[model samples]
Target chain A: MARLTLDRTRQQALSVSVATGAYGISFGALSVAAGLDVWQTCALSLLVFSGGSQFAFVGVIGAGGGAGAAVATSAFLGLRNGFYGVGLAPVLRPMRGWRKAWAAQVTIDESTAVALAQPAEDLPARRAGFWWTGVGVFVAWNAITLLGALLGSRIGDPADWGLDAAAAAAFLALVWPRLAHRRARAVAAASSLLALALTPVAPPGVPVLAAALVAIAAGWGHPRPEEVPE
Target chain B: MSAYAWMWVAIVAAGVLSWATKHAGHSVPESWLENPRVHRIAAFVTVALLSALVAVQTFASGRSLVVDARVAALAVAAVLLWRRAPFIVVVVAAAGVAAGLRALGWG
Candidate 1:
């Protein structure tokens, strides 16, 4: 059983890393398409390392939004990462040292979710899963981003072939599997409706922010105790 | 603000915000982190955020909400997910559906 669990964790880490990495290619291609140089795009990928925020920043810049607006937008979208850390803190509790810094840098959505889903007795294994998945996604994503930026220069307009759709499709692929309950379904519907309604009234990232808030409210409305089995 | 300058500021802000949140629960007494209520909220918040993100991606573009090939593909993916299909299969099938629709000039 232990061996089986280990294998399952490894497989989950590998799957998430690959899926997350594949989406980075779109970011690279789109960043350059948005008028950023390869170095700029790579730097953003390396430093920002958050797909949604990077997309929002570039999208805002591409639309000729001011720098302040772009920064504000990106910051808003990044709020979820903060929440991710809070969720994973108990499951993958870090010991002080360089490990803590490494944990902080890699505390992304997939890593947190995978870690938190592990059994309570398997904390160490869970942390390993989180680290492996996070590092794997980060390294693979940046590498693909570089490749995409170089290839995008010659690929003409990405919009023609629906590269944007590719990114959305990739995200959907990650998200589709998580809606396992009625409450989750309802929250998703509410948040999406709110975002759709606000899309025309807000800027690129603002609708996402509005949706996030609505989802949070929905979630807060129904607080299920944590003792419930996974 | 210059583009690079603003980018740097945003990066710094994100880094700081991320660090603060990760360390907040840890810095507090062990009691707070151990609270059942806290854990519940954390779990629910993550789900909520993820749901919101998925919804936004499926239904909303930059400034409009239109039913397109992506939506159809999402429906297919959702069905497959409900049926407990493998993750890769679900994603590939959805992407294939979308790509096929685009090829047919329906997107």
Candidate 2:
């Protein structure tokens, strides 16, 4: 029984990992097309490793901002991942010494979501899923990023071929699966609307930050009586 | 900002900030995670964050707001998602619709 559970967990992790990792190609190609060099592009993937932040950083650079401004903006956007780590602490096995750092480094969106989605009975399996997905995504993302960066130089223009759309498409692919409830739907709608409204007024990353604030405000009040069932 | 002359101090700063933010939550006391207030805050924060991302992707182009094929495709995707279409199909259909529109010069 344990072996079967482990197998299932591994499969789940691999699937999520592949899906998340494949999107790195878009990031690599787009970042290079946005005017970054191969080394800078790879460094973003290796060090930043967060898609939203990477996009923000490159977007800022593309728009001719100083590197300092771009980095600050990306850092602001990446703060949410820290909150995910806090939420996952209870379910994640307690680790001491070096393992804790490893766990922290790998605590990303896909891993957190997959681990949290696991059944309570499959705690060990869930842990495996989290770790495997994180490691798999990290490896695949860097590798694919390298390939995309190299290929991007040869391609005339990524935008002309719609390569630029891949990142947004990939994000939608991940997001569509989670809109299973009314609250989620409502939150998504509200946040998207807020962002759309703010985009013209704010800097590159500011809209995202604004949308997050809106969602936080919406979450302040508990779901209405009709929204929750006894 | 020449490629080589661009100061890396900002990059290093950003990396430090990103790492700190990403790691801060893990260091929070365990009790906070279990607190209902914190849970509510986190939930709302997530919604807002996602909304913001979706909005920017759909509407913003550099410094301006413009509706185009991508926005149209996103509208289609939202409808499909609401209809409970499979995720893969939703993405493919939306991208196809947008790409086709652009190719046809309607976007």
The most accurate candidate by TM-score is 1
Q: For model 2, name the residue pairs that clash.
A: none
Candidate 2: regions farther than 4 A off: A1-37, A58-65, A87-100, A106-133, A156-181, A224-230, B1-10
TM-score of predicted structure 2: 0.75
Identify the CAPRI category of the predicted complex in candidate 1.
acceptable
**Model 2 Cα lDDT, one tens digit per residue, B10-107:** 55566667767767766777677567656666655544565556567677887688878877787777677678665456656666777777788875
Residues B1-105 of candidate 1 have per-residue lDDT tens digits of 676666566556644554554455334455665676565555556655565566666767667777887787778877776787765566567767777788898
Per-prediction DockQ scores?
0.40, 0.45
Where does candidate 1 stray beyond 4 Å? A116-125, A156-185, A207-230, B1-31
Tens-digit per-residue lDDT, A147-178, candidate 1? 88888856443334444444454445444434
Write candidate 2's Cα lDDT for A1-230 as tens digits. 88987776676566556655666777788888878778878888777777778888888887888787788779877876786676566567476556776677677666765565455467787687678877888898888788888887564433434333433554554455445568767777887877777777876667776765665565567766333110
Fnat of all models, as shown: 0.30, 0.51
lDDT of each: 0.65, 0.67
CAPRI tier for the interface of model 2: acceptable
